[model samples]
Target: MMNALAKQSTVLDLIDEYDRKAAGVEDAIKAYDDACTAIEMAGTIMGTYVNPVLRGKAYVHAREMQKNLLSSGWKAIYSRLNIDMIASARDKKLFERTLADPPPLTFENAKATFGPYLENPRSHILRGLAETFAALDPAYKSHSKVKIGVKGLPKRVILSSFGDYSGTYGRDKLRDIVNALASYRGQPLMEHVEFNAISVAHRRGDDAILDGRVYVAPERYGKADEYQTLDRGLTIRLFGNGNAHVFFAPETLKDINRALAEFYGEVLPDAEEEGAKPRTGTAVSKDLQFYWSPQDVIDRALEFAGIIDLKEWRNNSPEPSRILEPSCGDGRIMDGIRARGHRAFGIEYHAGRAAEARAKGHSVLKANFLDCPAKPEYDLVVMNPPFYGRHYVKHIRHALQFLKPGGTLVSILPATAHYDHGELKGEWRDLPVGSFAEAGTNVPTGLLKIRTPSPSTQRATSW
Candidate 1:
């Protein structure tokens, strides 16, 4: 009887220890919840500041907090917790459905959308900030240091420097980024002030170092670099080492962040979906009407025509040939032909494009080549015709009529045209893929060369 009583007592002691550990775990969880609440409250307060200096300081602090949280492996922890919660739910299917159909504008959704931007240093948002800073500060040169001053803002903020060569940002490359940022204006995004700076750097052994530290004058903040005053009430200054100082109202910062999140998460996806739908009739006609050939493609087509020897054309030895371009939008091919010392003429269907070509000093007629009578007047014919619905076949056949008996015809046609139109005799060379991507199209193209039958061959065939 004593052994049984001792065993019961031992079991009770073990239960008591387990209860104590459970209580400790609950307390830890409560403390964690409290800390998160405090952080959220802090963020809310920081975002409400109106003073530029205070807002800037708050922005810096928030960024530091974000860096710390991300570095502490919170992402992995959150991911694991998310999975465990869904897996352990009373109804797993319902939990998954709820996650999939989250409230569109809720804080949780916004956080999920913008979380990757905060974590990635080279994200589009950060790069946009860098470019805006570079555009505002004229004194900001790549791999240099310069003082930046805001007219209304009094505080001088020093940005952290980058340590390596790969960290540098060039001013020339910021043009496209600046243009993209400008395009965001009036779209629920905040726009603002202008600031400029200039500085030089010297190479020290294998490292590039700024000549002097950035200095802001106490009175009037020094002379302004040639900059137009903007009314947006925000200023950004950049260093060549990719550090940037941004000054704006805290509310504006929130608005910009929210706008960007919406733009990336919703607007862009909708646009892509709209573009994915197949086009019919006029839509297809407008989209496929023109895809200008790149200069390299033009040179290759000229080489295939056997008019001017590409190697000795520059030496003024090879005789220049007369060339005609049909459907020459803006006369780019004509310019190439002229550059190679060839006599070039063009026929354009678009009035505005013909005027543009004429303005460039090229002889272009505002008429369709198909309507014009082919006189077999040209020594060589080079054209990049419309590639829609095998339209290139009609254009190629008509262009051949303009070629002399011994003259060659070179046309930039779709690669599939070579296989589809086996009736047309020619030497087809496939152009590199994505050759027209810079011109806003990705249609695979090939250069087709065909020579007219000379008098001797015609007579022999007639016999």
Candidate 2:
């Protein structure tokens, strides 16, 4: 009886596996049919309805304005402006009254909706501030002399020079410069530890050696970098070893810290934790690997724009392929994709980047890719994913899930990822060093090309 039960379990597992394979085949057929139908419909509409309509009177004035209104801030303004009531300027008294006593400025008002900066707190402003801070190795983990007090309001800064690289200014002058800058901003200077003038041999190298780092906050304090107005205070000066130093005022620091904490919430570790390792350049690279996909790289990935080789998706192939970029920074990769006559949709997490992408006329969703829900409807998925530890590997795994059964996933990633995901097999080629010059780092990178399993087969187990 026990042996019979074990056999029954084995049979059930096989049956479940078979059911999954069968579903994949059905999905493949549906995707193919859908693709062919969409392409035909799009072509017909573009050639017959769209081109003629755009040149016609109906589209030239009214429809064009309606369309332009939805592009950016115009939509918000148009909605709240009460166009119907304000359209006629014939009655000066009625117009004045309407303008002066407009409907209670609702949340729909652009000014009311987006603060003075025209940026939302949650999606735009706050996220940007947090991203800036998060890019820095936590203050506690930094090898730099300054320590940030994150636990309270008006975060305190502690300064201590450990190495003897105070360049020509010397350690004493370094401290004085920092103190003077703080005073200029009307902030107090706290405990200044005695600078230990270590000899060149005794001093170990540091990662944070100042390289003229400038922290700009003109909004909170007047231009700190100007030499004439703030001559008494030093805005730019060499720290030990000629490392340049620039800092923000206490109020500015408090505001930034608050935003960072709010954006991170429980996910960010406490900033005060001792023994936390500083984020190295490599670590930071992983988070902001927004390197644009080189045209040569794009050419190679698509097999010279040959994307329809997979047997499963042959039926519904788009004339100019449909492409999805999960982290399309400034839409560079998308630009290349579109240049090839393909339709590209992008997801950019940074508000600024998303805006730039929109300005370039590419459709982009300004939201975290992980948070956005996607359909397995694209013929290709392309990206240069962030390499924060397992992040690149995970992104590849996620991208695979969004592809039509036999769609392709192309990405530029650290070579280390080749070994991370054993189950998902792909072809990889080494990209030259310094391929990411815009990102400010040169690490061994590779182009990984992965094709999803054909519908006729079971899912890739490793993915």
Candidate 3:
């Protein structure tokens, strides 16, 4: 009975194989029929007289184009997948066996090769298609060069009208052709010999069109199908069998590069390296609520608080010579405080930022200010707290405890900080919208000068 079961299983497997082969043959016939229909339609539109034999030849040529397109598409798509996926034993073997192979560009082939992965409906061919698309430009309008195979017996190229409802018909066709030809070359061809003919259609209007003529069309025009839409002088299409066409405009090329990068999961290096780096002067840490106070603002706040006479501090030492600035990112405010003939201490939350402050010869405590023990020894307290909701209130209330009796506190806080929090009160002056621009924020801020009352004035002025 076991032997009979084994024999029956083998027979069933053979039957399944037979059915698969039969289905493949049926699919091939259908693909040929479709190719014939496409060739006939193209010839009819172009007014090319193709007899039955010529039609057969055209069918072969069209199939080659299709093959090239699909091959390029697959190559692009596979190249962008994560290394783990590509390096799997199964995929590795597939890749090794097909190194010089441009898989035949056909629906039947795609179905056979990719059916398992495509079982999930989310599988797509856009990236591979974009690679093929990028290959069509004779000048290779790409920052990074990719070789496209172009092994073919074609001095003259075929021009097929891509009439479809899809908005990306031109881009899709170009990718198809590029991939097809690239695969044919066997070796990668970074530069491509120009196409025989290229034609594209876009909408025309002098109206308020936001996306340009290529993207927008009328109600009657199903997107990308109107061939004559190019006749309105809105588009430039390639024509005749030539090795030279034109490169895309800067903006168009930019958009293409951006799209390709997204498809390939790549981030292009910034062309202008200078512009890419953050401007250190204006950079601030929002998480730590560290904002760099400008020298002018520092001077104004100190003078307004009546802690340091500007003329006296600049010329001689002030009465109370010690200053504290908690959350001193980069220590710009601390630097200003020291320049005014006063000793300054800073507590920076970020170690990296604290190091920067220390490098500039400032005393930086690399710890969160809230966690630090307050000595109440400092004569002045200055802080720019993070205004993420009501964080400024928490920081300000804590900072006040660090100043001694009759000591002054100067803070550059958000406008809302004054009205919402009544923990500490003093003379307040509203600053401009971009007053803290050096700190990398444009939130409107106010300068507050609050002084803890002396023993004598404590009773006169209620707490």
Q: By TM-score, who's the top model here? A: 1
Which 10 consecutive positions of candidate 2 have the poorest summed lDDT?
Answer: 266-275
lDDT of each: 0.52, 0.48, 0.50
Scanning candidate 3 in windows of ten residues, the lowest lDDT window is: 226-235
| Candidate that beats the other on TM-score, 2 or 3, i.e. the better one | 3
| 1-463: candidate 1 lDDT, tens digit per residue | 4555544323234334434544465455556666655655565665564433323222223334333333233223334333222121122334345444333232344356434434642233323433343334322211112112112222223344422344334333222223333334432121121112122111111111112223232235566323233333333455566654434444444433433232212101111112334344311223334567788898888778775644454554766777899888898988888776677899998788899999999998888778889889888999988765456777889999998888889988765566444557889887754456456443446789899999899999999
Q: Estimate each model's TM-score.
A: 0.39, 0.36, 0.36
Between prediction 2 and prediction 3, the one with superior lDDT is 3
Q: Estimate the Cα RMSD of every predicted model relative to the unseen true structure.
A: 26.0, 28.8, 24.9
Model 1 misplacement above 4 A: 1-288, 309-318
The lDDT leader among the candidates is: 1
Residue 451 of candidate 2: its Cα lDDT?
Answer: 83
Candidate 2 lDDT over residue span 1-463, tens digit each: 4555544323234334434544465455556666655765666754464442222222124333323323312333433343222221122224344443344323345344224323422323333332233222234111111223444332333234433443333344344433333332343431222122122112333222222232222333544321112222223332454444434454555555544443332211111222234344431333333455666665665563354333345566546667899878788878777666676899988788899999999999988787677689988898887744446666777777789987888887654466333444678775543344335343335678888777766545545
Clashes of each: 9, 7, 13
Error of 3 at 374 (Å): 2.1
lDDT of residue 393 for candidate 1: 76
| Ordered list by lDDT, greatest first | 1, 3, 2
